[model samples]
Structures are given as C-alpha cells and as structure tokens.
Target: MKSTTLSRALLASSIALALAGCNSSNSNDGGGHTLPLEECKTYQSAPEVIVLSDNENIERQTITIGATGDMHGRIFAYDYALDSVDVNAGFTKISTLLSEERAQNPNMIMIDLGDTLQGNSAELFNDLPVHPVVDTMNFMDYDLWVPGNHEFDFERSFLDKNIQAFEQAVISSNIVWDKNSDACATNGEEVPFLPSYQIFEIDGAKVAVVGLTPSWVTNWQASSPQNFRNLDFKNELESVRKAVEDATAKHQPDVVIGALHWGRKDGGTGVHKIATELADYFDVLFMGHEHAQFIERVEKDGDYTADQLNISVRDADGRPQNQVEDKNISERYHSANRHESVKVIEPGSWGWALAKAEIELYKDADGKWQIFDTTLANRTVADIEEDAALQQEMQEIHDASVIDANTQIGTVDGNFTFTGHVSKFGGDEAVHEDPQFDGATNRLYTTIHHAKVADMPLVDFINQTQIRVIEEKATDHNGNPVKVDVSAAALFGDSSNLTDGQVYLKKDSANLYMYDNMLVATEISGEQLQNFMEWSYSYFNTYQEGDITVSFNKDIRAYNYDLFDGQGFTYEVDIAQEPGNRVTITSIRGTEFDKDATYVIAVNDYRFSSTMVPNGWVSEEDELWNSADETVYAIRDMLTEYVAETGTLSAGEFTNQNWHIVQYGQTDAEGNLVGDKGALLKARETEEGSKLWQQLQNKEICVVREESRDSDITIAVNYKDGSTWYENPQPGTYQGCVH
Candidate 1:
C-alpha cells in the first residue's frame, strides 16, 4: 500500500501511534474509517509513482508485503491457558489491521519471517507438552515459518520434536537433520538439510517461500550464557539450492519468496545481496538478522548504486560482488539473473515489529497469482494492539524468562520498566516531541520532584515543577496542564536493551544517567569514572552549579556505547602515572543537587534519572518513582497505562544523518571534531593546568620525582614565564597537554 494510504488509514483509526502522537490528524474518536488511496484525505505521502518508477507495467503487479523477523517465543507466554480466543484476540488486532488494509487493496499477506523463540516467556515452558508459544502462533495463522538460528538453540532435538509448533508451513531451506532419525541431530549431525521451500496460495496467488538460516549458529550455541547447545549450521546457499530446485521442479509458483534466516544490517554483508541472488531462484526475498534493518537499504537487485556508497563491490564473475564482513554470513545466494535479488525485512528483535505485504493477484496474467504491486515497512508497535490474552501470556512469559527462585531478597512496592524513565514525556518530554508536533516551537515546562524524607508529612514540593528550585508550567501526569520536570530514573536495570512493553522489576541497585553523568557517579569510581565521563564532554562538558535548563536525552548514546569523555561532571586529579591509580569523586552535575557531594554511585540508573540519580550517588532519597502506589510495576506502570490509553509506541526512525551526534568516524580526543569546521566537541587540550594543578605546572624543573611521593594526585600548571611545573601527567606531555 502507498504511504498515502497508510497515513489515511492511520487518520481513520482511533488507536494512536505512540511515537506519532502529535502527527495524528483526526482529533475526534473514529477508530473505524476506511478511505481508498485514490481519495485519501490525510497528510500527503511521497508520490507512489516514485516508488516503482524504475519498472514499467511490472510495477502494476505490486504488493506491499510487511513481514517481521526475530519474533522468538513472544507469542506463547501471551495467554496462560493458551486458548485460541486469547491467542486470536492478540493476533486479531494484527488480523484486523490486515483486514482493513485488504479493504484498501486485496492481496496483502502478513508474514512472520522467523526466530519465533528465545527471550520469549514461553521458552521457559518448552518442557511442557503443550508449547504455549507454538500453539498461540499456530492460532495467529501466519503465512509461513522461517527457521531462525535460535530455533536450533535447544539442540536440534527440540526442533525435531516441536517441528509442528509452527501452524504455517515450516520452511528451512537452510537447516538439516540426520536421515530417518525423526530428530535434528545435535553436535555435528550430518543429516541432509530440510527442504528449504514452501509454496503459498494466498488469495489464489502462487508465492513460494524459500527459507535460509545463518551459518553463524555453528559458532554460537543457544543461549551461550546459559549453556545451550550449538549445532552445525550449514551454508545458507546450500539449503537454498535444495529448496529452490525442489519447489520449481515440482510446481512453478507465480511468486517465489526467499525467507532466509539472515540479517539485513551489520550482518557482515548486505543480506539483500543474498536476497537478490535468491531472487534469481525466487521472485521475492524476505530477510531477517541484524535486528530489523531499514526497508530502504535492501535493494531488489543487490548492493547500493555507486553514487549512494561511492563504491561498488563485484565478484570474479565481474558483476556486483557482495562483501561479507567479519568473516560471516555473506552473499550466500547470488542471483542467477544477477538483477533480481530479494525484498528483505530485517524486523526488530523480540517481536517488536511485523512486516506485511500487499499484492494484487490478477488474471489475464496466466490465471496465476503473479504479484501485481508491493512494498514493505517495519510496522511500529505504537500502531499495534495487544491481544488481551497475549498480554496475559506476555506477563507469564516475563515471569518465566526470569528465574523466580526464592531469591526475593528485597521487595519493591512497585515494578518498573525502562520505557517510562529512560524516555520521559512531559514538559521537556513535550519539547522533545515538538519537532514532529512543531520542532521549531519550545513550549516545554519541566517539573522536578524532590521528597523531604527527613521531614515527615514531608514537603512534597515540586523542584522544577515547584521543587526547591525553578518553576515552570509543563505537561502534567494526565498529559495536560500541570507542573515541573517529571523526570523518572529507573531504579534497576539498564533500559537500553528492553523490548517493547516489557515490565521490569525494580531492584535496590538499579540506576540511570541524568544528563549523561549519573552513570559516571554510580558505575565508576576513581580513574575509571573519570575516563568514562571525559568521553561525554560533548554533553555534560559544562555546567553552572544551579542551572536546570537542558534536556537530559539531548546527548545520550543508546545501547550503552554512548562513550564518555569526562567533562564538567568532575575534574580528574589523575595520578595514574604517579603513585596510585587514583581519581577523585569530583561531582555529578546531571541531577538535582548533584555534584555538591561525594557519592558512591550506580552506573546506569543514576544517569537515566529525571528525579534524582540514586542515594548511592546523592544524599539518600526514595529512589522509586511510584513507591506509595499499590502496583506491581513501579516504572512499568506508567508505560502500561500510557499504552493502554494510547495503544501505540514509537521507536525513533533509522537514519544515516548524525545531526544530534557527531559521526563516530570524525570525532577525536581533546574534543576536536575532525571535519566539523573546528567544532571543538571536547575541551581543547591546553598547557594551562586547572587551578588545582598550577603549582605542579610551575615547578617543572624535572626534579628527582619518585612515583611514590605523589599524593594520589599531582598539581600541574603551565606558568606565564618559561618555567613549567609537573605533578603527574600522562607521560610524554612535558610542557603542557590536554588529558
């Protein structure tokens, strides 16, 4: 379907897209509106013609197909009883979405690509006779099942035993089993691989699904941290060969589907190339791996045009060659046609997204189901509806995924999730959303809360929202007019790796960085903390003691690699080279009253906090956001409520533009941005020592300085005169240099 059609469809739907809250055009309640693409009244989408202008009448034979990858075992723990009503209710929403779109067109087939196990709540109950996950999935009625690397994680035995888990045709053109054993031989089983193909007759259209799995499973066993077994994963091409030949030889499907268990982004190679080559064997390709890649990156033919990358890859065959990096899964399937590769969809890991394909099955076309038109997208969970039964199952799965031994040493009054606190949504939160709602406008009001625990019936005054500090009119708890910064810091666990709508329990030791500095205070101490914070100079480099005027999320690095460069958070009295590998607990300016006192900090939670870092890093305070509330979920409650009210979420889009962040390749130490027109991203390295180091800078007569004499610190200064002093520097930088 065209973007216009989707956008229009969005306008008609009463359910909200979490990330797209501000973009929703219809204010009134209209959850059921249906308008055709020709008469769409929503925001205009990019011209549909541009999407397929490269092809002629073939463009008419298009189907926008959306498929999701790496679902794992998410569907199973969805309902406790694992009943069809519950499973179908959960899937019904997706089905409803599919049905609505079908009204727009006719042949949209929603495909669940692969990886329907692992991290799934139901995986905990795999030993049960009734596999909740597989059964629910079967009820969902997916078009086909593509084998994932993890499917063989429990050893091939489980796969062999549960081959029937998938209600759809199980296609693993890449996996194999020992002959006549009725079980996937584990630990080097030499059986021939399974037939890699599945033929689908959707709306009377012939679509063949040829599946392939990454050979990387050979190196990584199932849940390596948990001692899951590793099996021999054969070449992706080997299985494709078997499946393709078999499928076409027996029956010529109008459309060939390549459901390879390979990834799209950062999979060492452009999986699209594999898709393209498979395209030579198959008509279309749906790929996985790399945690859901951008739809635009996977080309039907192969590698991007030279103009796009300024380079081209070719093989001995002299055409475009595929480059597989990291010595891993590469172009296993180079197309025989060399022109049509695959239509890949590297969907989000852990069931975060699902892709759907809408095609027209037309006649006068040999009366076969030839694809008439098509497109793909990583559908955001924000636009999704949670099946009530699925929700229950999800909870059970969560309970199962986590080991619930009598290890409950501490009981938090409420539960938590990273989505709420890591990504705040009030004043500053509202301002953050303005770019879409109006990026040019800044009407954000921040409310900061600080409880006076020392004083009973304690002062519950708002800090930024009316705390002991600045006051501003910001979004309230109801998402309406209220008070100051409502920043919440998740008390336990890192919020980075959390899947959509996951409810996490709060432990006493969890924390996040506030303004990117809390992690330093909590996670590191001495030199280690200093080193981490120094890298973060791009964000927390400067701060006046009492200023509360910046967005905390502005300079964060997601996935925990938001490398740090210590800046204003603290001045390191680095004495590493002198006597002791010591650094000082200078300050943590990313919070309310932070940096005022020396603290023992928790790395992640403190930095992500909007309320306060943590008692470990600051003066002790109640770390839990909704501690008094009678909810199992502390941080998780807010998000669940938000979703229940809004029914959608929005993960940021994938883009190559590094506007908020400097391209990693260009940034350098001492804060010099190589190609950014002298943008000193970090403090310039200088000879002038901080006031604390002046004496050392002035006394630099290369005295008989022994490494032991230094006071776990060195004073340094570059004097006005030629003389220079040195307490302890990083060595080799005598006169003066940046640390």
Candidate 2:
C-alpha cells in the first residue's frame, strides 16, 4: 500500500488535530497532514519471511551521500576583519562544492540534517514571504530535510507555513500528533508528523534512509510550551527501530541509511548510543546538532565462545582492539550469527564543511547486493570559491538586510567599550598595568559595577524598560504592579564603536543582533539569588599570588556572564576557593541580605532558559513571568523604543559603581594577619604585581597579605567588628581552565 494512503487511513484523527493546531479551516488542502510511512519502506518483504529469488540479478553500483546541517541562516560568508567582506564558508560556496561533487557522480544525494533556518540578523527582516534559505535549498535540489529543535523556535503556525513552502520531503520518525481527533485514526494510534524514511533508486539499487530527531525536544532551552504544544517526541531508538522494521518488511532495501538530527556532544540524547547498538542495521549515519565536525567507524565483533575469547583482544598487527567480551556473547552469536559495522559523520555548522559518504555495492553469489566498501570524507568550504550566479541572486536580499542593520537608532555622548584592565587580583588598575588583559574580564567587572556596585545607567536603563513593560501588562494578585528587585543583561556580540556618538540598531547589516534580547522574569529567594551570583562567579578561575594572569573558565558560555542591576551587593572572590563557595554577598542596599526574602528578577530569555535554570543554577518553578508570552516586543525592540524616545545616551546616566571585588583572605581573632605576607608584599611591589594593598585601601575591605615561611601565601580578612578570618593557599601546580 502507498505510505500516504496507509498514513491517512491510520492517522485520520492525528491529521485532523494537526490541521486544527495549524488553525487552518480547510483540511482538504493537506496543509498540515503527516507524511505517509510507506514512502521510506525498505525491504520488499519482511526480512524474516522473505524468500530469496534465485534468478534475481544484482549489479555493482556506487552512490555518494552529501550532508550538511545547522547552517543557521549563514547564507553568506563573513570577513571578520572588514566585517562585510564575505570571504569564508557559506551556502554559495557550499552549492558550488556540491555541484562539483554531483558532476563527478550523478547518483549523489544531498541531505540537510536540520537547523537550516534562524540565527542570522537577516532573519529579523525576512518579511519577503519566501524564506531565502528554503529558496536556496530548492534551487540546490535538496533531496531530504529534517527539522532541528531550533525549527520550533517560532510558533506552530510559522513552522507549518515554512514546511508547506518547502519542496523537499521532510522526515522525522519520532514527532507525532494526537490520533484521537481525526477521522483517519486506525485503532486510535498516533501518527508521525513527517515521513519516517525515504527510499531512493540509485542505478537499480534501492537505498532506504531513515530520520531521527533529538528525543528531548520538549526540554530544549529555546523551545516554549506554546510552540510545540500538540507535538510528542518518542524514544529515538525505538522510533528508528520501528521504521527500520517496517522498511525492511515491505521494500527489502539493499542498503539502509540514517539521516538523524541528533548530536553526539554536549550531553545530546540517544544518537550516540543508537549508533553504537544499531550498527548492524544501518550502513551509514548522518548526524548533527552539536555544530561540530566528526567522523568515526564503529565496529562490533561477533560474539565469541569462551574458548575464542581472552582478557584482551588484539588484531594481527598486535594492536589492542576496542572489543569487549559479553557474558551472553555465545547466545548473541548463535542467535544473530553476524557482526556489525557502521560509519558515522557530522559536518560542522554554518556550512563550514560537508560530510560525504561513499557506498560501493557489488553482487554476491546469492544475487543479493553486498557492501564492497565504504569511505567517509569531510569536504571543507574554507577555500571553495563562491558560486557567482547564486551570490548575485542572493545579493539583493543581502543588501536589504545590510541597509536594515545600518538604520540608526540613537546617539551616545561617549564610547561604550569592553576594554580595560580588570581582574580579581587587582581592581581596575590592572588595566593600567597590562593592556592586553582588558577585554572580557574588564567588561565583566564593569557590568557588575554598573549593576550592583553603583547607579549604572546602562543596566538601569535596561531594567527600567523591562520593569515598566511588565508592570504595564502584569500585576500582583491584588492588582498592584509587580515590583522587581533585580534586572540583568549581558554584553552579547562583539563590542562596536558606539563611542563615535552614533548608534545603529546593529553595528552593520552583517552583525545585526545581540543575543540578550529575550527577556524573562522570575521570583527567587535571596539564597537562590546568591547561588545565581555564585554561578556567575564560577566563570573566573582561581589564582595564587605568583599567578600573573587572571583568566576566565573557558567551559562557561561567555554570554552567560551577566551583570545584575537594581540590587546593591558586594562580593569577595577567592580564586583559590571552590565554585559554590567563591562568592560571598556582603550586603544588599547597605543592609545584610535576608536569605529567605523573595526577590523578583528580570533576565534575558537566553539567560533564564538555558544558563540559569537549565544549568541547575536556578529553579524553573520560581519563574513568575516569561516575556515571550507576556510582551509583544523583544528586549531589542524595547531598547530601540527606549533609545528613540530618549534621543540621547550618556555614560554618566547609566554608570553606577556600587559593588567591588576583593581577593579573599583570612585573619585571626586578634586581627593579626598570617601566611606569606612578604611574598604578597614582594609580588605587589613588582610592576606586574596585583596592587592588593592599594585596592584594599581604596575599597576599605579588611583584607591583608601576610608573610609566613611555612606557607606559600596567607590571606587575612578583617571584619568591621574586629573579627578576622585567615586562609592559606592550597598546594598545586595551577593549570588554567579550558574552553
């Protein structure tokens, strides 16, 4: 039976519900109907039941599969130096490379693993009714497309509209809709949102391709409940297994391939394990989602008997093998009687490269096609020349986006720069000592200074916008405007020359968006707030007295470093301290912080959804408001409005320096300092030495570096009440953090 007919017959209810969710009145047009399963059917008959036809003739054939994913709307390459030079990997170059490959082999299949849309600033002005990326893909004649998690960032209607506009067959085995609501329900079973797989006839050979998505879509940081309300994600492996079984049963395909949208890194779910366990079922696996490039060949030796197995297995080359002997190896070998091997590859994101898998098949004695050999290659786009015709075709859209990005929003009297010398060891004076140290660490310090240390106009401006907007829309249960205690912002994207006294909504059309544009508000106890600050503090790596450079933890997302405004708090960071214990909130608005007190906080969506709660730095249950649902405008739009209305920007208006960082130390009850005060003093006297004494005198924090022959470094922090805490540096060769 045809896949569409069977799907319609089985999932009539699901189709109806999906159409309803799309808010379409006409179901006859098939606007939001699920894809039929038979389209990807593999075998001509069930593998267990099929009888081999002795007379069938099998011939040698070769096929090439080219794949790319997570392009993220990077249609044009970037020239970082000139900013608009268009000199690197992009769709135009990718198209040229794919075309060249196709010329070499007419039997090539082009597959996009997923995350093709979104990410570019141009997407903001993409009101042309036609998605440029989809148009480009159609021009390239893409064979199949899968939706990545980011595809669901927009509302369901938007997603449905885009899917309707695409010409390629979309496939995902796991996404399903409610089956009870449509007339086509077969036993009330849920049906796939898209075809589970597809079959291609390459030189008289049938090759089956199955699709899989990340099973944890609902929990995605960017996915809101409203965007994917009616959709359900099933176990990725189970979905693929079912699809493989169905395909093998009906088509008896000679080759089975998997085009999966799941990634193998950053704690991605199932795809890695699925590739390992199901190696025998698939000939090739195309994977994405981590935005990384990788290729690996996974092999499983057939189970061995006790006599055939040893403590370790070695190949003829005397090299150690990666084989493990299972206790039930004999059972598996007797039951399945086969070994498994599969090749997996992923192209890096943003069209940097394309993953190519070559499959060579030859006829076996039994007249069945058998894999002769397989090879994987990653073709990089760094040196590939852009396709001139395609570039010309997209040039107009690119120009328009550039113009939109250059639209002037406002002007400032002074430059907003991220450069300065700031470190935990010394205060702002560190910049005076080492100019190269300025960038992120200094900007971070400034952010904290403006947010909590003093009346920071920039952060305050952002806070006021969020607070005013939220107040206008939402109220407390008693109908009063909800009061917010803290507001946060991040220095997203590269710093621009706003110092020229003019500001555009974006730096240029090429660099158009700041990431901290989505706002979310939540309520948390003071303890949670402190914990959140501690999480921010985790960005800094601990350093000792002789450590010349104070660096940041590379593993932490740079954008997650947030500066909080609306609260007055001072913190002391001992680089030598552990993560959770590094930050000590000295006071709030000149008073001791009440740990049990509840405070409302306003933060960007990226910060709230992904960094804070998802990372376990904050609790999701404490969320009080999400700007995505509560407001009509994003934080960027709000900033635009605020700037346009105010007409002028001044650093003094936003500059608040209320908080200061102190190098942590310890002292005794009698207020006498301990440890290597001489080392600390000698280090401070050097040109590169952290001027700890000056910083302490300026900030009035009772911290002193003391000398001791027995200790490498000793720190003493005195309280205003005459009590002191003393500490000695832990012993270790300090290796800086990793990215």
> On residues 1-739, what C-alpha lDDT tens digit does candidate 2 reach at each position?
0011112232333333322211111112223343322311221211222121222344776678888888877677742212353433478878888888889886688889887876664344233334567767777777788888777655555456566556657778888764543433446567677778887766566778898877666665442565564667788878988988888788878778899987553343345566666777787788888665556555543221111122111223422221212223212211122236566677777786777877777776766677766666677675678877777766654554454445565777643332222322211222211111221111211111212211234444566667666766756545667667767665443322234255544432122124324566677778888888788867665645553223455456545656665646544455567677866666665578788888788877667766667666567776666666533446756666556667776655554443333441332221123333333334555653344334333432222212111111122321221222212132111111100
Off by over 4 Å in 1: 1-66, 72-110, 120-123, 178-190, 202-204, 222-231, 265-270, 297-342, 365-371, 388-408, 411-739
List, in order, the clash count of every candidate structure: 118, 44
Scored by lDDT, model 1 comes in at 0.34
CA shift at 707, candidate 1, in angstroms? 48
Across residues 527-551, which tens digit of lDDT does each residue of candidate 1 receive? 3333333333322213212111111
Per-candidate Cα lDDT values, in order, are: 0.34, 0.55
- TM-score against native, each model: 0.43, 0.70
